[model samples]
Target chain A: MEAASVLERRNFNGLLDALTARGYRPIGPVLEAGRIVYGPIQRDSDLPIGKTDIHDGGMYRIADRPDDALFGYNLPSDSWKQYLFPPHSRLWTATKSNGSFTVAAEEIDPPRYALLGVRACELAAIRVQDTVFTGAFPDRQYNAVRDDVLIVGVNCGQAGGTCFCTSMGTGPQLTDGYDLVLTELLDGDHRFLVRSGTATGADILRELPLTPATPADCAEAEALIEHVSGHMGRMLDTDGIKDLLYDNAEHERWDDVATRCLACANCTMVCPTCFCVTTEDRPTLDGATAERWRTWDSCFSLGFSHIHGGPIRTSVKARYRQWMTHKLATWIDQFGTSGCVGCGRCITWCPVGIDITHEVAAIRTEEAVHAHR
Target chain B: MRKPKLAVWKFASCDGCQLSLLDAEDELLAVAGAVEIANFPEASREVLPGPYQLSLVEGSITTPHDAERIQQVRSESEFLVTIGACATAGGIQALRNWADVAEFTRSVYATPEFIDTLDTSTAIADHVTVDFELRGCPINKGQLLEVVNAFLYGRRPDIPGYSVCIECKRRGTTCVMVADGTPCLGPVTQAGCGALCPAYHRGCYGCFGPAESANLPALISELRRLEVDDATLVRALRTYNAYAPEFRAASDELEVTG
Candidate 1:
């Protein structure tokens, strides 16, 4: 049953307490370095209440929102992927003795997490990663943390200057992929209109000091989502975009973008579903133990495409094309869904203002190549 | 198998890169066990001669005498690997490359006649072929160990050529340039120092030098958009690895001398 309840902002800490009481370490968006970052939060005060984010192409700043709303920020610099699919993880270790060695698996059982303030786009991103990690060949590390984690998704009450969740069809509303979803109602009463998406969510909500949400409360929540829907900071024309990317493999826009693209891997790293990783055997100088670790690798890295002799995608143009095409086009073929969740972290976090939306638009326009020349 | 003989040599540097080997304190024990220290004047007084399996050169070719010595050192070692910015990109001393050495000596030194130095401070690669080159101002000790370990095991040194942005993202450092409007060189600077400056809320000094896809002009334009002046940007590029081809070229292009 999708039971909706009204949770007072004053008693939000009780929700955190309920989760913690049930042995869940809550991870949420906290203010860090004048930016919103996903980190561990113990109580309500830990959340960036009264703060919202200002995000644009290559620009982001956290500013005081007019009112105090806990989940006021839209997209955080970090994705939920870092918690599930960690950037650096040891896969295995080998110890040597008398010219022969034995390898052992680095099996680990991580703690259960209650991911609070997860956005709809972030939830969608998690679902995409779930398929990537669990399908065909499963990643042991990802599945270990993914299985028992509880997600507390927050619907978009505010949209940043880089948001395009409306176009991506991933957000502004929480449809699925969350245990409990919260819609922070900041109008007159500082309260949250909470709903349970799953049985666990219902149980958790039952423990919280919640009052029954009226139809008006639900309607207001719906209206807020609708308002956010019309206020997307960015938009993309995804109509036949997959085919367009496939056909425009030789587009000169790639070269044009290359001139501005740092190939710094910020986009892929900030991306919720970019799962490319490279493993290195780190043997200590003593020749005793060697750890084989798989760290997050990006196609932007020249070494990412390295074979026996040298890297295949050596040029910035080739790397940029590979990332964009794979993300927009080939990813659908591989995972049956577009890789981008429209969080716009890639655009916001890039040092240069290289907007993927603009790139797609440029490719779609017939005169874009001619205009570039 | 006999432990490979390792030699550490210096030319023109602050010796911080040489100290990085000593700074690998716990790892130094492992390094000592793995290789025979044939020559390391900084760490030891006793020096063993020639035909070393590995030579870790730590400085730039700045003097006429050191220029010929590097060639002699190159011939004695099976594999010659440059250890820091000095060896890889001529370090901060390479700032002399743009300035007149005679004028510099006359201004800084009491006796200009005794100061016999090359006008230009060039990287080891400019003088002799380098088997491998490690970047960074002082070089990361962990990476230093990894390089040494790789050579011992006969494998390719897995040094990344990506920007500091990747490292910042990996380590969960907020993008200083994007988030705080701080003029950072992380996007153009190579990944090595674990995005150190950004973590501390300071812009990257470009100590590790230009990345594989620096795209300096684009980065500079963005920095300019952030209201960073050309003089400050040029100063950022002319730090530790000033003579690094990409940084040098970009700095020269953007140099706003009053």
Candidate 2:
């Protein structure tokens, strides 16, 4: 396995077969109900080929591309968070008999997964989750699933309308946290410029028929990154953004955003790095046995801050402020990394077009004027 | 240990919520084992007397007699729970809150003089205190079972007050409004149906009613931008959970603007 090899489009299915042989269930994007979602990929046709994505604040859809190009679209509506920290998973089970109780921790047997379309921002997000789940206090379940994951990253050919990965320095080009990386070159021969990030990644590539990549292929991949960076539809200035949000605690801008914010938690639900959850115990009807589960939760929910008397964040304004401030500012202190990866999911999936980049810029602009005047 | 007595009551609804309990075929036997089904007319003909430990009331207060009946039902039960859109937020029939009921009765009834009704249809909570409210067009049977089970075990039911988008994301369903041009009420609507309509490529008609602090104005404005006519917005809001304060106010404003 060389440093840079070309896997022609014809031999793509063999790549999937190689991953299967190594006990990795390949997962990739598939079009469902007019949008792309990650599901099991058994064949090459399962990929969203010849699909061109149209993304904007509060809007996302796919149309036909003039040429057949798999992995043409940006991030799917749902991220890879579902694979790692699943929505609902049992934690433990308890059985009661003769006034005595016996408890058994939920035994986990997660599948070894090979993620096919890991974008740069998504890879950054996975790393952010790594710190949250595997930091000082490790989540046994998440660690078990995360350990078996094989991330096959992809470099972007084009940017979505709401994308700001370049601004956040998380994407358009990946740095690390990938086993294998790919650049789908369009103008040249319909082929992929595949590179290995780890030894295991090289091992899988050995199973496929590969040719050494020419200098032209490497240059084309570089040019593709520059093109995506230049044509990005959105931008966010991260200059003192964390401090700016922290300083403007009572900014009237929050009230304005609240007028439009549904507090539906769409932003958090779609955000790749927003790791928040709640636990519940499901006791059976007869009181003989009980099962416990952990489910995804959001700070935008009123009950997410429930204390003794009532919920802490009651108004939509308070909840919205808490979310943005924590995402850009407080998350750094708590997790040692920014909670947002600039995936643009929070913007595009919002029912109302409430862009975070726009919100941050608005506050920054207001503060700049006040500071000087 | 004797099981607690459970009673089911109906008011101005179609009895769909009561049917949801019967639909829980698997949980129904377990429920019967845990609680003596003293007054579930839908499941049995044996009508037990009053002072029930738990009362599951369905439907809205549309008739004058039913309004008085709900008060009696409340007094006879230790803990009263409202089930379905009608009992919680005055179901689709709450459309009459805006129109002339007398004219409607005259148009539909053969003998209009014989019909007795109130000027406005309202939720059960308007008449008596509701310990809990289960939302849906017809409540989700799983959630209904959870509620019954929770009450039996002396704990609050684990019902979420979040939007349907959470459930949609969990179920791996793409956003219908974002992916397609369909105007959906999922953002303002509460989660309970497991995002049923969105999974099937249909916009949520708000069967579960308004979520906590539902920003109807925001959603309505977004729908308007999607080229949804004002008439459609009004009609969408006035559906299953029509008189839920947030939906009611939103529809009323749209009617004025339309």
Give the TM-score of each candidate.
0.97, 0.98
For residue A81, model 2's alpha carbon misses the true position, in angstroms, by 0.8
Give lDDT tens digits, candidate 1, residues A119-221. 8999999999999999999989999999989999989997889999989999889998789999999878889999898889999988988999999999999
List candidate 2 segments past 4 Å from native: none
Residue-level error in angstroms, candidate 2, position A282: 1.3
Best candidate (score: DockQ) = 1
Interface RMSD of each: 1.0, 1.0
For every candidate in turn, the CA RMSD to the true structure comes to 1.9, 1.3
* lDDT of all predictions: 0.90, 0.90
Model 1 residue B156 distance off true place after TM-score fit, in angstroms: 0.6
- Which tens-of-lDDT digit does each residue in B1-258 have in candidate 2? 888899999998999899999998878788889999999888889999989999999999999899889989999999899999999998888889889999999999999999999878899999899999999998999899999989989998999999998899888888888889799999888999999998999999899999987998888888888999998888888888889999888888888888
